[model samples]
Target: MYVLIPAYEPDMRMIALIESLKETNPQPGIIIVDDGSGACYEELFQTASRMGCIVLTHETNRGKGCALKTGFSYLKGIGASGEVVCADSDGQHLPKDIMRVGSCVEPDSRSMVLGGRRFSGKVPLRSRFGNSATRFVYARSTGVKIHDTQTGLRGYSTDMLDFLLEVPGERFEYEMNVLLTAAKYGYAIKEITIDTVYLNNNESSHFRPIADSASVYLPFLKFSGSSLISGAVDFVLVLLLHSLSSSLILAVWGVRCISALLNYTLNRNVVFFKESGIRHRTAFPRYALLAVLIACLNYLLLFLLYKKAGIPLPLAKILTEIPLFLLSYWSQKSFIFTLLNPNG
Candidate 1:
């Protein structure tokens, strides 16, 4: 097994982590990517190299994701078959925890391990809030409840090298993206609790709250943004058509056709466009079929809510959309807009 640490302007804590690892029996090979943490930090990187880590350097500052890929590429080139455990340079991940995560790696298994931290102590406000919001969004988006979605300690088997190289993100979002689609690529996620250590309230971290948060939350934000846009149009049209025709069925169907068109266009070109095989001329027909089916389901739900539940027409329409929203998201991702290849 190998440990990959991506460092940018790192301090002594990183050396302490490396020193701790060197004391372990049957010590793992370590790979450190010096992410352009220039002159002053060369001593730290040099000390790491003297301790037998294969230190790779970047001439300029590439993001963490790129640094990780660089480390993965190095592993691939060297024909390394063991697991690669990724840890931060901030001294958060303990050597034992890293070993625990790395031990889950198997030659034939497609599972990734995460060292989840329970923020039980006095956690930093930004760190606590960020994890909470990200976990909520991740659960709502993927239906998977991951406790610590912002953890930097993770393990990956060598078999995932090709796919990891393909997943897109140049910064912190890259890790989240990997989790977002890990199951889609046939990988099961396993989590193990680890020590939560936030030194000086994680003050040494380089994560920019505004810019990096935007990158990390891009997937959820983009999809929701599209939904809000289409929903606004649907809201306006449903009210207008119901007022004009005085028939719920006509209003629902007419507005659905228009709103579905706009939603599909946005989702196809913007939302799931990165999914393999989606940039072709294939998804529209499948999408149209899904839309028609949804229209039928939408009308039925509206009818039940309005007629049987004694709900007002507008309220019923709103109630009906809640369930259908999940359905549409699932269908579009699972069938309509996804790549055809199961193993790809």
Candidate 2:
């Protein structure tokens, strides 16, 4: 096994972490990628080297992704072909959890082991909500049912290293990008709960809420945009049908029904795009149920807006269905085209 730590301006706590790992029953190769924490922290690197661990140095401060890439290159350079466990410099990860994840790694390890954080018992409200939202987005985008999407402590087999290295984000978002890419490449990612230790309640976190969220959510937002196009199609069809036949309220519903089916089909094939091979069996029925739910809610809201609010029927149909559009996106992501199919 190989242990990789990406450190940036780490303190004495990190030395303690290294010492703990060194004392493990069956020790593993340790590689520290110093992301240009420079002369001040060279003593730790020197100590790590003296302890028979490889210390790979970066001249400048590169983001976490670059540090990880550097670590993979170092692993390849040393001819080490085993599982690599990446833990943070901040000492939030416990050594036992690393070993637990390591135990799951086989000779030809092909899966990624994520150290899932069980954030229970009065975890900070903002932290809990933030993680929950990101987890949902990641699960929807990648079809990986992970509880913690941003956990830095993870184990990836040697074969999976190249995939992680090629991922595109520079910082924390790189983790999310890798998750999506792993799903794209058909890699199996399993999550196991690990002890939670918040060194500073995330005081050292480098996350910029808005900017990082934009990076993380860019794909989902694009998916939502696609759903919007579908919504527009459904809306236009409902309006057109209402105009052609005044008595055919059922006809308007039928047009929306057809349009929703088209929207769901395209979104399933192109937007969420998971290959469950369930099109013939579960896909249509599940989608039909979702469409019916969305249509009923949309109609009720449109009726209320048009009759009670005294708005034009066509205009009300457009206005009231906006919320329903968002609802359908979430519904479809969570239920409709998800990887819950047994085959997937």
Candidate 3:
């Protein structure tokens, strides 16, 4: 196994961690990526190199995701055929915990093992709140219940390197993207409890909570935003067409044709577009078929609610959309844009 550390503006604590890893029973090769910490940190990198780590440097500062990909690419080029365990250089992850995560890596099993922290102690307020909010949103979006969505200590087998390199994100958001993609591709994620250490309330972390959180949550936000805008356009067009034609069928068809085109474009180009190999030729026909099905169902429900159930037309339209909204999201996600063969 190889130990990979992505360091930026690190301190002497990194040297101590390196020394501890050097003394392990079966010492693992250490690869540390200097994420453009600059010339001032050259001495620290030299010290780590003297301590027997293969230190790689970036000319300028790149994000943690880039640093990790650099390390993975180097490892792949060298044809390393074992597990690679990634740990932070801020002294939060213990050397022993890093080894523990590495020990859990099974050669044949493709599962990614994460060193999960319980957050039991006096955690920083931001750390606690961020983890809680991200966990809830992650579960709601992907139906995967991960305890720590932001854990930096993770173990990956050699086979996973290619896929990891393909996942999109540049900074803190990269880790979240990995988890989301893993869940989507049906990769089994196993979490092992590890020590939770926060020095100075995790002040060493360079994560900009607002900006990075927005990047991490952008996928879900984009999906919801697309839906909301499409819904608004549909509503306005429905009312306008109804007023002009005085026919529910004409209004529903007109609104759906306009809104469906808008929603499909946004979803295909922005929302579910990352690394999703689905071509427009394959996805558009399925999407058009789903649109027709949903349109018919929506109009039937609207007619029943408005004409037979004694409800106002506007209220009926609103009520009719709730179920179809969920159905549309599910069908588009599962049938229209899904990988034809996820395992392949």
Candidate 4:
């Protein structure tokens, strides 16, 4: 097994982590990518190289996502056998945890193994809230409940290297994008509980709260934009057509078909543009089927809440939409606009 560490301007603890890993029985092969850390950090990289690690360098910082891809490409070039695990250089991921994740990597199994960290005891507020918000968004969007969306401790079996290299993202957002599209490529996620250790309250992390957060949430934001615009069109057309034709069913169905087309166009062209192996022929039918099912459920929920439960129609419509919105997003992400890999 090989452990890939992406380091940029790292501290001495990373060296310590490597030394500790070397001490373990049947020590794992270590590969480190120096993500454009300048001369000041060269000493650390030298020490790692002298200690028998394969050190790859980038002249300028290319971001974590790119560094990971570098390691994956290199591994493939060398014909690396056994498991491949990635860990942060900030010392948050313990050696034991790294090995635990590596142990979970099944050969030829399409699984992304993650070292799940439980944030117990003292934790930074930003870290806590950021994780909570990301977890909520990921779960609501993908219908996959992952406790740690931002964890750097992840393992991939040999079969997933090509997929990892193909996933889009240059920096912090890349890891999130992997989870967002993993299922679409026929990969299952396996989580192993690991310790949560924050050094100096995560001060060493290079994550920019404003910029990186926007990048990480870009897909979710785009999806929301498409849905909002489509919903608005649907809303306006429903009222306008109903006033003209005096047929609620005709107005609703007409608006639904129109709005779904707009949503599908935006999603395929913009929201999920990075995904492959899906075209209009395969996706449109799946999207339309999901839309019909969602429309039926929307009416069913509206009927139950408004007529049976004595709630106002306006308020019931709003209430019914919340679940439907999540359903729609999950279906589009995991089913409609996803890749189907024949190998995996």
- Please name the candidate that would achieve the greatest TM-score relative to the true structure: 4
Worst 10 residues of 2 by lDDT: 335-344
Q: TM-score of every model?
A: 0.90, 0.68, 0.87, 0.92
How many clashing pairs in candidate 4?
A: 0
RMSD (Cα, Å) for all candidates, in order, is 2.5, 7.3, 3.4, 2.1
The candidate that achieves the highest lDDT relative to the unseen native structure: 4
Candidate 1, position 313, lDDT: 98
Pairwise lDDT winner, candidates 3 and 4: 4
- Candidate 3 regions exceeding 4 Å error are 289-335, 338-344
- Tell me the TM-score of model 2: 0.68
Model 4 misplacement above 4 A: 342-344
lDDT of 2 at 283: 68
Please identify model 1 stretches exceeding 4 Å from their true place.
235-255, 276-280, 342-344
Which wins on lDDT, candidate 2 or candidate 3? 3
Measured by TM-score, how close is model 1 to the native structure?
Answer: 0.90
- Write one digit per residue (lDDT tens) for candidate 3, span 97-136: 9999999998857589999999997999888888887897
lDDT scores in order = 0.85, 0.76, 0.87, 0.87
Model 2, span 1-344: residue lDDT tens: 88899888788777788888888744788888888898999998888788777888889988888888889877776677878899987788899999888777765655688899989765655567778888887765545688888788888888666566666777767887777666655668888999887766766666555676677786567667777776678668777777787657766668766776677667777776643344646667887887778767877888788888899987997787676766666566555665552223
lDDT by residue (tens digit), candidate 1, 169-271? 8788788888877855568888899999989989998876667778656755776788899989988999999999999889987897898889988888888
RMSD from true fold, candidate 4:
2.1
